[model samples]
Target: MKTLLLSLKDVEQALSMEEVISAVEQGYISYNEGKVQQPDIVSMEMPENNGETDIKSCYNKLNESISVKIASGFYDNGKNNELPTMIGTILLFDGRNGAPLCIMDGSLITGIRTGAAGAISSKLLARKDSKVVAVFGAGGQARMQIYALCQVMNIQEIRVYSEYTEELPKYKEYVERNTKVKVIICDTPEQAMKDADIAISTTPSKKYLVDKSLVKPGTHIVAVGADMAGKNEWDPEIFKGAKIVNDSIAQCISRGETRNAIISGIIKESDIYAEIGELLLGNKPLRESDDEITIFDTTGMGIQDNVTAAQVYEIAKKKGLGKYFEFI
Candidate 1:
């Protein structure tokens, strides 16, 4: 019995924001160097419940990330207090032997990794002295995005916004308590973005939550909500004024949120300055001036999951956190 396994708690305990950011940067660099392998996401639309729907993202990447997410949303808020409106798990495998390694909680991994991607983007794109951070959608990812920003930036105050009125106070209390950063729940996304150096979006709506006019001269925006096809968070003017950086051009065009901009005559695919890899590898510039606006469309690629999961697995194995079993 190759008796060592890892759980979600184990992975969470072993990983830090800085570590996650480093791994995400490495994943980006790997792509730029042509050393990483990725595939288009294959998914299925699950049947509905009380007129609500869910989706399953099935992915495989060199045995490191072989998992599916079953995510559903039900908005009968007044009725049963719908659970999270999202739920999923990960099934990690031994890439070398094609054997089971661990079945861990993917929620925190997904949340932290997503937030770390935002942090990395902000680090590369935003003004270094940025102090005011605006976050649209006061939800799970919003919490982490701001947390990472607080960890990395000089943010003295955080402004938050969400469409759901009921969740604002809860989000407000939680952020200020955990981050120890003064938090303000703004009434609108536009209000939140005003004079802010960085803005992050974490909603799944099919519309734009940010305004091009609200952002000042030098602002970095990390759009993480629209990771799928047909979802958008900004107009072309936002990308037009900023250096548009993508996680991956092909995926962004085919299914990511950037696809909408490309399709709507708002932006040309050629307008993209570079992928995150180019910056991570010193092949391209990230931030040039104090007045430049930068946009990062973070439709996550597979390599992120592969590398992060691999890191968690390695650390957990050394720490002896879980039990290994024979599942060949």
Candidate 2:
């Protein structure tokens, strides 16, 4: 048997947000149907070095494929080493016989599929006429989140907030060039969040950035930053009155935004409305009314990584984009 080795450029050329969203949605469906075997994420944190790594894996029974991903984030890498803050790799294997299939870059897959998770949440939870967007981050994930949302919703105006004020215009220009959505730079995070139909937070801030007071009723907040313990973005108080949907109830309670809320006594485990997978399976209802405030807390599921990487691997193979090596 031969294993394929794919590069970052190859993965990027083979995958798109639209296709990833579709693939990820199926992952959620399979998860809800009890067809995916996913374990708790393994986390390694180094506070002294300002770095962390997470190992995730899952077996998709429906597709008979498995993927294991290792992703790392070193916040000071850009300042100290001029490297990207996040890096990752994925290994794809055949579930039927445990044969190695592909080894590929996972950073691009992570960003795109994380964005796809947000898009899936918005499609099911956001109001039907949602047009204006408030995005709190100017990084790669932020761009991809907006890209995925635009694929599913009719986003017209976008308000972006970033600590790096100068990067906002360049990001704005990039978005305008790639998408028809108009982008505005906000002086404050509050300025970006006010009266917005949808808000996405993609930063890795230790402290809460979005205040509960700034969020209006009917707003759908996609909290994507709080994927690890001690990483949070939204105020826990927001959960007191909002309907909370997390990617995984267990994952969220331990490391997602819901963890902070639960720790602060603002909410409890029973307060959770349902997992996004449950909503996808029609086991729970979506936003009951346009006036309801809904929050989707995504911690990035292993099943998502497995299915998305599988899709990318297949596409790259069919396109003859990567190198193949025989080992067994």
Candidate 3:
């Protein structure tokens, strides 16, 4: 049989933010319904190089496909190597026979899928009139988050706070060139989040960046950085008495921001309001009022990669977008 090889550009041509958002939403529903088998993530850290790598896999019964992804983040790559900080590859297999079907670059898919998750959470949990967004990073994922969010919310302004001040102007320029939203570079996390309706953190900091006191009522927070143990962005205290939603309770508790909260005794596993799937399936209530604070903790899921990669592969096949080679 022939296995297709897709490059990053090939995968990009096959995906749209709106379609990815829809696919991620369905992935969540399938997960909640027990239609997906996602294993625990395997992670390795290279502290000396300031890098981490993760392996995630999932089998989706609904899509009848399997995806295994190896993604790595080298924090100093940009500064020292002049390369992207995040890089990855995805392997897709036929669920019926376990035959490899496609191999594709995973960097773009990872960013967009993650961005889609943030957008989906905001659509389901944030207030409808939310116009201002506070973003806590200025990397590719942060840009992807803003791009995906623009598809769902009528955002007027984006307040950005990043430790890398040199990147702010470039980030702002990119956003303004692509969208109509005005971007404001903030001096502090508080300045960025003050009165913002939605806040998203996309950094890889080991320390919590947003304190509980800085978060106001009626704000929807998306915690995007803490996909592994010891990586945190939101203070545990922010989770207290807040409506918390997770992409996967088990995964989140083990590695996501939810882990920090539970470990700190600020919240319990029972305190989790709902998984995103539960909210989508109407098993639990969404934001009940505009005054309620809500948070979505996502540790990244293999089902997300599976469903998205499945779609991308199909599209690549139909369009003859990638090369094929025989593999026995």
Return the top candidate by lDDT.
3
Tens digits of per-residue lDDT for model 2, 222-245: 999899889889999999989999
Model 2 clashing residue pairs (backbone): none
Model 2 lDDT, residue 173, Cα: 90
Candidate with the larger TM-score of 1 and 3: 3
lDDT value for candidate 1? 0.73
Give the alpha carbon lDDT tens digit for every residue of 156-274 in model 3.
99999999998899999999888778999999998999889999999999998998889889999999999999999998999999999999999999999999999999988999999
> How many Å off is the CA of 263 in candidate 3?
0.7
How many Å off is the CA of 113 in candidate 1?
A: 0.7
Clashes of each: 0, 0, 0
Question: For candidate 3, what is the TM-score?
Answer: 0.99
Native-referenced Cα lDDT, model 3: 0.94
Q: Candidate 2's C-alpha lDDT? A: 0.92
Cα displacement (angstroms), candidate 1, residue 28, comes to: 1.4
Tens-digit lDDT string for candidate 1 (1-328): 3534555567778688888888888878877877665656654443345323323332344334443433333444336775555454656655556565666556677788778888888888888888888887877888989887776777788888888877789888998898888888888777788778888888877777776678778888888887777667776567775788888887778766678777888789888888988888888877999998888888777667666767777778787776777655
